[model samples]
Target: MADQITGGCKCGKVRYAGTPLDAAPFRCHCRDCQQLTGSGHTEMMPLAREGFAISETCRIYEMQGGSGQSTYSGFCPDCGAQLIRRSARMGDRVYVHAGSLDDPAQYAPERSIYSDAAQPWDAGSIIKAD
Candidate 1:
């Protein structure tokens, strides 16, 4: 992982910086992730919530997650760029959308979640879960 992870919204209205958590990055193929990203999956990098900080307030959308807990999606109000994902099940960490990273190339997803929900077109891209 990078020394310090940094990213922002598409409009640069909501920037974020944090220390990367020790968790493995993952690709999620859940329906909610598909809809939120408008793609087959969402690549996420976990960050320790203790030091995570966002430059501006983000518009958050809350919904029930697969774990039967509240999950929040944070986005840029101006550009509607999805930047963060947080779930009550994992309060100590926040997931940052890999696409939102300033250096997206640094993102390396090690596993896939909800792979059973993966669409046919994207099924081949699923990385085996560790």
Candidate 2:
């Protein structure tokens, strides 16, 4: 991953730039992730919240996370494209959707989260943590 990460919504209504908190990204297979992404999982890259900057305010959706804390999903109101995810349990970082990155191909998930929640058809996609 690049030292400086940048990305935006489909309509370019929402944009963000930040320093990566970790080089190893992860795939989330929680039901909320599947529903939010309309897929089997969501690939996420972590960014330092202190270094993160957003061009515009995003529409936030709040839900209870697996940790029993509040989780927030940030997206473009205009394009309805999901861009970020943050949780009360992990306040120091924000997780950016890999697909929202300017260079999606650069995203390579190193591990799978919520692996037990993976759908049968997508079970093989999970990457066990090293």
What are the C-alpha RMSDs, in order, of all predicted structures? 1.1, 1.3
Off by over 4 Å in 1: none
lDDT of 2 by residue, 20-77 (tens): 8854799999999999989999999999999799875688999998899999999999
Off by over 4 Å in 2: none
- Give per-model TM-scores: 0.95, 0.93
lDDT (0-100) at residue 105 of candidate 2? Answer: 83
TM-score of 1: 0.95
In candidate 1, what are the lDDT values of residues 27-123, reduced to their tens digit? Answer: 9999999999899999999999998998757888999999899999999999999999999999999999999999999899999999999999999
Q: Clash pairs of candidate 1?
A: none
Error of 1 at 30 (Å): 0.5
Q: Which whole-number lDDT from 0 to 100 does residue 70 have in model 1?
A: 100
TM-score of 2: 0.93
Q: List the lowest-lDDT window of 10 residues for candidate 2.
A: 51-60
Counting only residues 3 or more apart in sequence or on different chains, how many pairs clash (N, Cα, C under 3 Å) in candidate 2? Answer: 0
